[model samples]
Target: MPVVGIIAEYNPLHNGHAHHLEHVRKLAADEGIVCVLSSNFVQRGEPALLSKWARTEMALAAGADLVLELPSAFACSSAEYFASGAVSILNSLGIIDCLSFGSEEGDIDVLKTAADILAFEDDDFREILKSELDKGLSFAVSRQNALKTVLTGKSGQNIEKAAEAIDQPNNILGIEYIKAIKRFNSNIEPVTIMRKGQGYKSLDRTSPFSSATAIRHHIRELPDLRAISNDPFLKSNMPEACLNILIKETESGRHPIFPEYYSDIILHSFRNMPAENIASLPYMEEGLENRLKRAAIESVSVDEMVSKVVTSRYPASRIKRIMFSMLTGMTAEFLDELKSNGYAQYIRVLGFNDTGRSLLSQMRKKASLPIIVKPAGYKKLDTLAKKLFEHEIRSTDAYVLGYRSPGQRIGGQEYTSSPIISVR
Candidate 1:
């Protein structure tokens, strides 16, 4: 059977997500839908509202055939690395016929054109990018300026349109996804579904399809998850099945995992860590580690530390990634090695139904990398793969500390827990 791949956090599956999955089912027809999901920690470098397994169950219930884990190293990195990692995994699967994503700009041609310009940056583009960067503007702003300058006369009005498309959050990720496809030279066709409801960062709950940020914010505002059952806001915004799972996880003391829960550990870790070591983590550059060290010593919370260190050049997201890297012992050298070894070293099964079982069977024979269905598979991996898997283990151990229940905070769940096998 054909397979359509989606890369997402699903942080907690909302109605918008269910809508997207329903569309994918129609678009794929008889094909299986494979979702590459972020782990407990998401792209923003925060612990997911619910554990990965809970999210996996949500995805399976929402129409996904299979769900796979995006390694922690790439899951918490910047857009480029995140997209690259997810796309690489799909490419390695050898059965994905299309890669589908939600974007503010639903036009594939626009995203592809922008992706082409970025994927194959010429000398002129680089020089312009450097000049813009030297002006003290943020990287995102600088790249937009650089692209506008480079595509000035070549594309005419298309330049303005492409530039606008690049400015939106989802469009930026969509472009990166297309760029990664080009980088991998994969055959998977790109498909874009126009995003519905509020913007990615909007916390507005007026709409039925509220943003994940809004949903999470609403959930956090609750005195406890006990209110979730009667919360009309959640009832309208999330699918019944997903909301039920969230409710179950909440009652079990496993819901609403937040970054602040790990603040003390992060602060303690940073205080004990040397500046030189912090400098070695991914995204650390040009004495930023020193600033972070000072922030760690001065601030009482992760939010305060981030506020102190974040700047136009080093945005809050970047700071969080650096902090998370330190907490999980992720280094630039290790990530570089993984990149050199082709981004993904193995396919980690997170959840699957019968359709997914068949897909996994096909992957076992055709996938470029080893297919890992259980922890025992770790021992069979190569050296680099072993190291990467260890990083995931460390990340999970650190992540569980954020759980409300003391019993749920136990480490090594990676070895004990199995993928959610949905019986449908």
Candidate 2:
């Protein structure tokens, strides 16, 4: 059977996600849905509202056939790196025929055109990009502005409104996904499903197809299960099965992890870290670490610390990634190694169903990298792979520190946790 792949955070599986999966299933036409999900931390540089295992169970319940992990290093990265890591894992499986994603444009051809332009980065585009960056625009804004200018016609207007799509968060990520696929020269075809509901950043529930941001806002406000079940808006936006998972996780003290939960730990990590060590962090540059180190010592809370550390050059997400890097002891050397290697060394399975088990069998036959099903197998990996896998473990251990229940803060949970399997 053919395999269709998707890359997602599934932070708390909502109606929009369920809709996407249904579309993937119909588009695949009997092919299996293989999802590469973020673990513990997400691209936004925050702990997932639910743990990876809980989120995996939610995906299986929502009709995904298989779920593999996008390792912590990549999971907590920016869009380009995050997409590259996810697409790399799916490609290494050697069986995925297509990669499907939600897009505001819902036009694969248009996304591909933009992706090719970005992937190639011709001389004219490069000059414009450098000019925008020099103006102190964030990388995302710089790229979008450059593209808008480059695609403009002789009349000084954007051609066919090509630049508008890149302004949306989903379309930006969708373009990156396509660019990553092309960068690897992978054969996986690109597919897009028009996104529904409010934008990704919108916190207001506009319809049953609410954004995850809106769902998360609801989760933060209504901590009681009875209240959550009674809230008509949330109930309509989230699937019943997914809601139960969130409730069970919250009740069990394994969920609703907020960045504030680790404020003390992060502040401590930064204050205690040696000044020289800051130079070794991924994306560290121009004495940025010095500003962060000073901020950590002066600020009393994580929120204050972030506000102090954020600058024109360093966005909030970048600051959070730096905090995570320090918390996990991730070094510049390790990031260099990853860049040189270009992909993960193993496929880490998060969950599966009966059909997924069959897909796993095919992966075993066709995969080019090691497939990790148990913690004991870490010893069999190469040196870099083992080191990278250990980083994931450390990240998870830090993730547990944010747990509301003291008992749930126990470390090494990644080693003991088993893949979430759906009963037939």
Candidate 3:
């Protein structure tokens, strides 16, 4: 059977996600819809509102035919690497005929053009970009402006849709996807589905809801979800269980699960390691290692550390992702080694259903790579995918530990939350 792959973070399987899945299903009626998902930690460098298992089950239930986890390394990266990682994973799956992504622009031709031009950055564009960066514009903003000027100046391609061109989140990511698709030269077709509402970071709560950012903020304010449940925006798709988990954490006076896991690790890495070593931290770049080293030593909270290092040049999001890697014991070298393996060799199921199982069975003969029915089942992948699974498992453990009364056994909660979800 033909399969279409969607690279997503489902983050919480909200209404927007359901809409995308539904659209892909309708568009690719002749094929199965496979979603390559980021587990636990998102590209934003925040712990997912729910565990991967929960998100996987939600995706399968929502409309995804197969849910495969995108390893954490690629999951928490910049637009380009994120796209490359997701694209390569889909390419490895062999049966994916197309990749459908949500974007502000549905004009695949324009996205394709932008990707093509972006791929071949000539001297003129490079100079303009560097100059803009030198002026303190964010790398993203600089690139966008540089591309626009170079296009207008050299190629006579005036992008009249100026508002549509800049680093509006979904489109930025979509451009990356298109670039990745072109770079790989894989058989998989690239398609961008237009987003219907406020853009990715907009706090607007109109209709089918704003981005995950808005949802997260809204959820954090409520004493409980009852008030928001009545709104068209909150349809119970946001995972009440997950928020309650956070509530438990707050009530128990425990540190947020992530801080609890990595505080010592990060503190140790900061105090003992050289600033140069921070360069090796996954997602570290552009001399931010020294900035991070100083911040890590002085900043008391994650937010403080983030604030200390954030600049227009270094987005707070990127800093969070970089620090997340340090906290998790992940390094750029390790992820680079993993990336060199190139494509996902195992299709470990985060969740599945009748259609998903059917698709899995159909792909067995056609898939170029092994579909890992269970990561825990295989002794070998259990090692190679160890960091990937451990992050997922630890994130879950951290969540469950949040539920425990203060001073409860940490070890007990770890395995309790790590139970492999049975795919029936």
Candidate 4:
């Protein structure tokens, strides 16, 4: 069967995600759908609304055949590393024929052109990007300006259209995915599904196709899990299967996790670390560590601390990632080591259906990397792989600290849990 790979967080799979999966099914003729899902920590540098297993259950229930866990390190990093890590894993699978993602700009050619420019930056582009960066602009803005300038001068392309295409969050991620495909020289073809619904960050809840951000916001505002599960807004917005799984998880006190849950621990972590140690964390630069340290000392919550330290050059997303990195003990040295030794070390199965089981059997023989169905399999990995697995274990332990139930907060779930098996 031809396999289509999707990279996503699926924090709480809603109607929009179901629509994407439906299109992928049609595009692939209902062949195997493989999702490289984010771990407990998502790309936004916050704990996922539901556990990875619960989210995997939702995916399998919705339509996915197989779900693999994107290692926490890459799952919580910036778009570039996140896309690179996920794409590398899909390529390693040795079965994927296409990579499907949602984006505002549905034109694959437009996205590909932008991706090519980014993947193979010319001297002029680099110089322009550096000049923009030096002016204290955010990396996203700097790249947009550079891309617009290059596109205008080089190809006489519609500069405004190009800028608009890359401005949307999903479009930006789509470009990164294509860029990673080019970087790896992978055989997987890229496909984009134009996003339908409110904008990525919109909080509107009137439509059935609501943004995940809106769904999460709705869940957070509710008084308790019972109230959330009973909310008619959610019932209208989420697919039935996904909504059921979400309710089940929330009833168990695992859904609706927010960054504020980790405020105390994050502050504790930062308070104990000196400025030098903070400087060692990944994405640290320009003495930002000193400012972060002062923010931690002065602020009472994660939001306050982020507000204190965040500037135009350093967005809140980056600050949250840095703080989570500190909490999870991800360092510059560790990330460098990971990059040197293939971005993703192993394919860790989070959940699978009957179709997925067949795919796994084939993957055992064809995959470039080991397929880890059980946590004990980590014992057989090489040095770098083992280290990466251990880091994920620690990261999961840190993530669970945000759980509402004390029993769920226990460490070592990474080792104790097995992949979720769903029979459809």
Which one is best on TM-score? 1
lDDT to native, each model:
0.90, 0.86, 0.67, 0.89
Off by over 4 Å in 3: 154-164, 224-233, 236-273, 285-287, 343-345, 381-424
Ranking by lDDT: 1, 4, 2, 3
Model 2's TM-score against the true structure: 0.95
- lDDT computed for candidate 4: 0.89
TM-score of each: 0.98, 0.95, 0.82, 0.98
Q: Model 4, 188-289: lDDT tens per residue?
A: 999988898889889998999989999999888887668766789999999988888887887786656889999999998888798899999988796899
Error of 3 at 392 (Å): 6.2
Off by over 4 Å in 1: none
Q: After the best TM-score superposition of candidate 2, give how far the Cα of residue 270 lies from its true spot, in angstroms.
A: 1.3
lDDT of 3 by residue, 1-424 (tens): 4478899886556767777877888876856788888865678876665556666766766677778877666777777777788887787766788899887777777677677778777887788889998998777888988877766634323244433455577878887888777777788888877886566777777656467767766665667544543544455434443334334434544423343344545555676778778888876666777888788789766777778889888888888778666655567887777667763445566666666767777778777655666544434554555555565454444444432245753643323433233343
After superposition on all C-alphas, the RMSD of every candidate to the true structure, in Å, is 1.1, 1.9, 4.4, 1.3
Checking candidate 1 for backbone clashes, the offending pairs are: none
* Candidate 1, position 259, lDDT: 91
Cα miss at 99, model 2 (Å)? 0.5
